[model samples]
Target: MKLFRPATLVTLFTLAVSPARAWDYEGHRAVNQLALAALPTNFPAFVKTAEARERIAFLAGEPDRWRNITDDQALPHVNGPDHYLDLEQLEEFGLTPETVPALRYDFVAKLALARAQHPEKFTAIDPAKNKDHTRELVGFAPWAITEYCGKLRSEFSYLKAFQHYGGTADEIANAQQNILYTMGVMGHYVGDGSQPLHATKHHHGWVGENPHGYATNSSFHGWIDGGFFKKIGGVKVDAIVGKIRPAKIVGDPLKPEDLFRQMMAYFGDTEKLVAPLYQLEKEHKLTPENEHADEGKAFLETQLARGGQMLGDLWFSAWEQATEDRYLVTELKKRPAASAETK
Candidate 1:
């Protein structure tokens, strides 16, 4: 009988003990699993292993776990906004997703300037509830996804150099681990984007005007997130797995800006569904007993598929376009031969 490698054993052990939950945990895991299913055969072989696959799936909830740290106000302040992007709020700031600055800080500066120029358009936040100081700004989901893609690309670049040069097995394993962690955490944001509620101001029910008389229950967001799925006995991943096409490169693999634009476009596509989602709920279609519950289920399954497809494309693009990390290559070449052989 063959034995599992030490690294593989460690991974399995860690996953067994880690408590994970996001997108109601199961939804997030399904998104990561779906993305894995979408990967082509030529994508990295190590990531195809069962342990690595489970690690990625488990990580889909990592971002939400950070939300659990109540003692650290700074953590939630910085991380909370990344899970969403209120497209409607962008207009109030005199910006469109197309025109929003790609750099996070630049966008922050722009929002500050916008508020200074037009205070009347903004509502003052109540300091009592604004402990995180994030209430004034719209979310940053697109930028978060794009940044993760770049990080994954960098990981691939270094891993390639390490493998091609003289890096030891442990070094290669570590680099692959980095890639898996980044991919899994990033999946959280990508999965967040797939939910139409995360892309709009109507997030926690219809925020303002009641023209459509959509759901006003604050619990509505939680319901759509995973409650409905739980009521329906969870997502049917295998049923929709076949619907996901093979992963392909998105935008220009060499251009970060192109990827940014594509992320914005993806959000725009999801935003278009915001009204329809509310309408479905208003009609009780999302309820398990509703005659059209399947319609709601189909809508959600398609969104999950969308997240999986986009994530797979980003992963494929990162791998396909990762260039040699020349600096790392030069550094690796300087290491002693024995060091490379030890692991």
Candidate 2:
């Protein structure tokens, strides 16, 4: 379990000085549009419609849009941390990459306890400096994904109830819209994890020593992220949407235990990519014009595609698991279709 080196304290402190959001608005939309396009026919009907797909794609950018709120306004809610998790910071909570508390509050509580016991492990979580900045020391991104997944699953279950009862077209459409909107929000964090930088302390400028000659350019993050994608036509919605494929999950992710494990595993997988991202810059394969560049372009494509695929899989899994609810069967059988139609 690699921890943040003490040498990077100043760098981390500098980073903690403000609120930073992840990816860019366009990147979030691209990832979610691709995911929506890949949903199987079995998904809720509304999500498959052209209008809902467009709405979902647009809504994927909502979280970052909220960042426009001044830091003071967003801090208490920890909005800055919602976009990322610096995996090394987990060490301060006595958590390794392989282990994590299942709930967001549990993780926070544990971190608070760890800080109380060993004050030296973290910079102070002072309320004076932005709380969003302070809370970002242990980012909320992983838990955000899990929590949204649970919300989506609940929405799916309710949609199933509506379907089972032969609900009006408008009623079912409303439920479907709710699920799609939740999925869009969920996809944003999943997209963040794909960026590699979002999962590490070396996010913007390189932290610590310059032993590897990785990019230390402060502008590198924005230059390489959505800016590059928007500059190069290769990552556009049409270019990516056709390529998405759902992930093959080993188990039912809608189960509480499985959902937690799956999200952590997804985060860990993205965490591993951070080093390689630097290596790309180290090798000169990554650059501001990387959208048209060779290996760098391929890497971006792969990560974005992976994000879209995982989002689709999570959406499909929620639908599948919701169908298994005993309530669905009970509600369907309790009323005949003809009887339900009369009301």
Candidate 2 lDDT over 1-343, as tens digits, reads 1112232224456653334455677777778877776776655576777788888888878777666555456443666677888887787678886677888887788877888888886666557665444553567787888788778878888787777666678877888888878988888888887888787777776776668787765555765566556666546667666577654443365355677677778878987987787888777676545453678777887888778888887777777766534666576666686576898
TM-score of each: 0.90, 0.84
**For residue 264, what is the lDDT in candidate 1?**
93
lDDT of each: 0.83, 0.71
The CA lDDT at 323 in model 1 is 93
Which candidate achieves the best lDDT against the true structure? 1
Lowest lDDT block of 10, candidate 2: 1-10
